[model samples]
Target: MGRSPCCCHDAGVKKGPWTEEEDKALVEHIQKRGGHVGSWRGLPKAAGLNRCGKSCRLRWTNYLRPDIKRGNFSDDEERLIIALHAGLGNKWATIATHLEGRTDNEIKNYWNTHIRKKLLRMGVDPVTHQQLPPDHHLDGASASLLPEALLWAAAAARLGGLDTGALRQAQLLQHLLHTIGSNNDATNLIANLAAANSVLNSSSRIVPSHLLQDQMNMLSGTNYLQPGYLCNTTSNFTEQDVVQQQLIKDMSPGTSTFEAAGPADQHCNTTAAFAARDVAPAVDMLPVQEFAGLMEPMELQLPNLCSLESDSFWKDLLEDGYRL
Candidate 1:
């Protein structure tokens, strides 16, 4: 006899965009329960909602949660998202952590609807987040480069849990990839980065923080390093250094691993290696002038929230996709 299906769903459970009442019920229940639900599958029954557990979880995580920040992409945020995506690809959940109050779904949507299109218009491949050399054509090897879904899975498994410092450096490395392709302005930046990377990788011995800082002093002027200061080194490796060292050790043979290049030519090697994989470092062809424009903080999009006098208006606006 044929085996029974491994899973089943109840036909009685309602499925649709959550109604305001349902949203209220779920939020109220969670709040009353001290914001902890032991089992999502059991929560709907407890809250008297006729929705599936997965649906409830998704609705709360993606929308109804009080802490989720909703809005259009800020210019700085847009740039940071690109930098993160350039190195990390489409790991939206992982990327979401870097942006406080933003949800993975929101980030994913903005990237698909806005950033990806911009990159494409600029001749950058959305999947690899790399700018194609002019008139360049993809060959068999480049054409078959891994998809973002697969890349995300591999990265998730490899990363286990992320180290923010490591992630930041990886993003910077990608920025370096594309920046190197631009005009002469990046020459000094490249030189400084090469020197800094060498100091970081030179040995297990304690690297004087000043040496790395002096090498990357030019980086201070760039958008990537502008708002943030590099962490002062204690007597040991930050998580970033450990990850970098391991990355250098385990990447495929002759794969342009960071360790393979000497400081004299590290910049060239770093860019060319990942470029071959179609995920060359850096944001999409974002040149110096464009960088200057993005540096100015642009106005953020806010919800058209109505007066609090009509409490129901808020729900109506949210349902209409205007008020949230």
Candidate 2:
């Protein structure tokens, strides 16, 4: 005899987009529970939904897509999105961290059709975030050769959890300099950065106490620092620096495991080497769940919110799609 079918087949309830009456039931059920309806699977059953857990989840996340701000992108958001894409690459959900209500699909579309062309038009290589070489200067450089600046961007992405494009540009620049730049140039660059920082600090003339407090807050929050800054002289950093170091290490044949030996075995050796040297892991991708919390409207603070009258950018990020 055949075994009993799955619960879904047996249930034989209606499936797909919930009806208005069904929505009422679902909303009522949630309201009764003090507006804290937990678990989509349980929710559907409580509201007499015949749909499966996955369907319910999709409906809520996509259509209901609560806390979703439905508006055109603001200039600041556009800049942030561009900067984030530069730093993070094409990780849309991760990119969405900075733009509330903007879905991954929306951002991906914007990048492919819109933002990318705009950058390229401005002489910025979308992938490298660098300017193209002059027409005559392209003699030695292969058209396909990824820019040296992007190498540092890769290194930065490998070494830091920065956005891929920006990091790639930075990394490429760093590597190229190290490979081709004279010691004097590196020193000069560092000197310039230092000088610029000093001038900015003095000119701003912010209170030292406030500045110190800001620094303290940043160090306490989820701070992203350059790899050089994260180094500790005496500790094995493999566990901590997994994302960044792993990306760089993965690129090399030595770290890429032998075919005969399993990847697990090869990684074991790499891990041991890392432990001995006190080298930490690399930073790369962002977790979606964690990022959602950052973008969630419920958690936004009142003080950081700019007045709607004064700032359209802030307004765009917060407002839902429907006109008020």
Candidate 3:
């Protein structure tokens, strides 16, 4: 036996975009009924429109609603969309819930047209937000060595006596690059490095360690300080101070913390310069001479990257995609 269709496709019912007159009719009809249309299947007839009930409902919900916001999306909205998409996959209807004025259709279109392309260009899989496999011929061993590279960079920045702000930025770049891998293209690599370097130069002011620790504890419920950790009893030093001092001593001149010969040592400065260039619009990267004047001698501490990893959310998004 053949199943019946959900919506009737009568010859009299129109399809496609709605006209101004049809819009007015639907609006007037809803207004007369206190904005409640009892049955969408009966809406077209009651509103004096030649459209299918499904079409009419779509138009009303996506376009003619009084609170519908149109035009360009704000930065906050864009970020919300990305985060939602990351957590929800292509469940546009669910993603739309967090965006006040956006429709599911609109969000779906925007993601396909804008965000997806951007992620691809950045060598990240839009669905997983993970780095794509690199082209080994172009990137060589460096392509697969991102984690080690980042650790070395962070250690170097600390040994160089970089201020806390620069150290934090280095940590952020490390996390971002490791998560969102870059392609082998020279331009892409340069852009990534420039962005990282810019992050360091733009904010040279140090945030108090106690305040940072408090925020971290609130978010992750983990103590920054471990029990029996060596510290001066009278000194008011945070965990950051201890980490920085350790890094400096470990890397100072004759230490085995880092090898003198490696790809990391050879390319660290160039990578930083490139990252700074990529993020130049948001924050300018100061020259070495200017950086010295602006920076203050402060201890460095690595952020708890593990606490920030939303594995369950990404897993759910992947599962949702598979289900759909």
List the candidates' TM-scores in order: 0.50, 0.38, 0.45
Model 3 has a clash total of 14
lDDT of 3 by residue, 125-177 (tens): 56654345555122232223122222343334332444444445544543444
Model with the higher lDDT, candidate 1 or 2? 1
Ranking by TM-score: 1, 3, 2
Model 3 score (lDDT): 0.47
Off by over 4 Å in 3: 1-7, 135-324
Can you list the residue pairs that collide in candidate 1?
A: 174-281, 174-282
Rank candidates, lDDT, best first: 3, 1, 2
Q: What is candidate 2's local distance difference test score?
A: 0.41
lDDT of each: 0.47, 0.41, 0.47
Model 2: how far residue 61 lies from native, Å: 2.8
lDDT of 2 by residue, 1-324 (tens): 885443355467567667877666766776688767687656667778777655665565544555766766665456456645544567787667557687777788778887778765544556644444544222232323222223223233333333433323232232222212111122222332222223323343112333333433432331122111111110233234323244335445554223333333234343333221222111232223322322242123322222212233322222211111
What residue runs in model 2 are displaced by over 4 Å at the alpha carbon?
Answer: 1-37, 121-123, 131-191, 197-324
Quote the positional error of residue 216 for candidate 1 in Å: 19
